[model samples]
Target: MEDGLVRSISSGLSQKGVRDHNERLLLSLIQRHGALPGSDLARIANLSPPTVSAILRRLESDGLLERGDPVRGKVGKPSIPMRLAPDGVYSYGLKIGRRSAELVLIDFCGDTRHQRQLNYDIPLPDTIFDFVGAAVSEISGALSPEAVARICGFGVAAPFGLWNWPNTSDESDAAFQSWKDVDLRVRTADISGLPVTLMNDATAACQAEHMFGRGKEFRDYAYFFIGAFIGGGVVLNNSVFEGPQGNAGALGSLRTVGPNGESMQLVDMASIHQLELRLREVDLDPRQLWTDPDSWTSLSRYVDPWLGQTAQELAKAALSTCSVIDFEAILIDGAFPPAIREELVGRVRRYMATQDTRGLIPPRIEAGSIGAKARSVGAASQPVGTQFML
Candidate 1:
């Protein structure tokens, strides 16, 4: 559980107006710090005990929270812990990747109750939306009527410049270019019959790490999510800070010199797509990289070099960002196995050690807890976070 100074309810609002805000705050607190008792919530929220009790009672009566077994303390009456009811609310998360797409139905507690995935040579708008419509219908139909009613909204996590990537065939390139004019939030709402929120896929992954991974330990950090293309997010004061246009941490676009003295972006240097291209050069099947039961042992000879180069690029990028914001940590995660992520983090740490840091506070380089599912889970969190949290 994360512990720190939490925002307290303002005394300026009228009691009637404050109820909704207080309710959301309590729910957000429970979501952050596991199950907490009313006394603890009151202290953290700076609310009177009676007011906390009133809000908790209302939340409990509404089926949004559930009480746990009582804990008998040293002298006072036993205190009962309260937590968000897992079945109280639900939302759908759809991740549209360059090489694949994923859909997940997550409960209020951020658990994936149902999920589906599709792999494609190139992402076509019509095919992806069709998949979204069909999957939402199929999954929602299996739930009880009450559960279906609790479905809040849909979230889509996709790349910003989806139309820019090169496709093998000109026909495929033309088809993919249609993404330039597509409005993901509006399209998804029309398909899923739910309100929609759209986010950059890597930013969504950072959100998941902030809420459910190691992000709790640092109030501010720069997050790098290595996908087909590397991208990133910024966290300030323990919150995922999506900028005004929602693309604050465009880490991939940071400039760097390539091997032959040409300028390149971090994406070209550190992305897994580079590894895929190398595997293809040697006649090894690259599809295994994205396979479910990931077996990268056979590809280690290729992966090792990629890891080294990626680590060096990431070390430079992390330092570059910190030179501006002085972040407390740098979190690295990706669409790969845990062991690979660990190795990548270790390598980044080693590389950072060799870089000159005369005046900067060196940030902690940490591995992300959520593996391949971070984007989908973070996408799911968008609706849940908006509706019932601060």
Candidate 2:
């Protein structure tokens, strides 16, 4: 990230942080369990009735929570249920892919209120920052003063050292070298005047899947987001395993034997970048695939080899990941059209089934529910996650 990030805490805000964390905990519980009664909240939160009541009052007064009509059934007093106020809070997410930038505004219910995408061959610093500023201004129109004020901040998810991938993005090394080693988070914050949190693009997508997609039903899984370059995140018992440098689930970096039995990274075979290379070999316009997959008629003929190679490599990566930490499922997603995603998942599943699983149970393979917006949604979710702790 070109901009530096806002630290998660300030020196004197620990007390306030604790209160906010507790509030977020309650909010998360409500989101997970649906509208909850005060009594149930007290029990679930392990708080006394009075404490829960007080917290509920605070949340209700702040408009972060709303109460349902009192229920009158089999009790001396009717209990009023509470749930998140969708209009009360909003967060922003920015996903900077190798080819484009996306901005999304999400509400408390995890619904995308507004989104905008800008495409470019290579996202130069000035162009991307300008686009973000315009997109933010545009999204602000969709929010009221209260929701705008409630905006936690922008979460940025971009490939680490994105400019270094001249081959994947098809840009001149001389032009993009300036972006190398740049503190994108710091620069983006400076340009946008909003607190920014950074995460690896793949990890951000994984977070999106867990919070908004099928991961809500599975505690452990290996997640792959096959964007321009394939990247992924690992979830262990519900938490994403962000390694020491926050690049833990980079399945793209996993080594595998190539078709010629040469050592190569999985990304070299499975990523959309490599797929584009395959299309270009047959003299097809690669941009058509991303911009308008429906118009790319040659996909069935030209992409078979790409799919076969990608599926095989994906299986290899999944097996390797599962060998170390057995998971309940394997999720695959990317920037492709929905039809293409399903096909890729199906192919990978078949290939994975043919592999040896004598020492471990084969995780169920499936397509992730969230699609192209996963990165932006995940990035935007950071503020919500940080604000709520869950």
How far residue 39's Cα lies from its native spot in candidate 2, in Å, is 2.8
Top model by lDDT, which number?
1
Clashing pairs in 1: none
TM-score of every candidate: 0.95, 0.90
Q: Report lDDT (CA) for all predictions.
A: 0.90, 0.82
- Minimum summed lDDT over a 10-residue window in model 1 is located at 1-10
Worst 10 residues of 2 by lDDT: 1-10
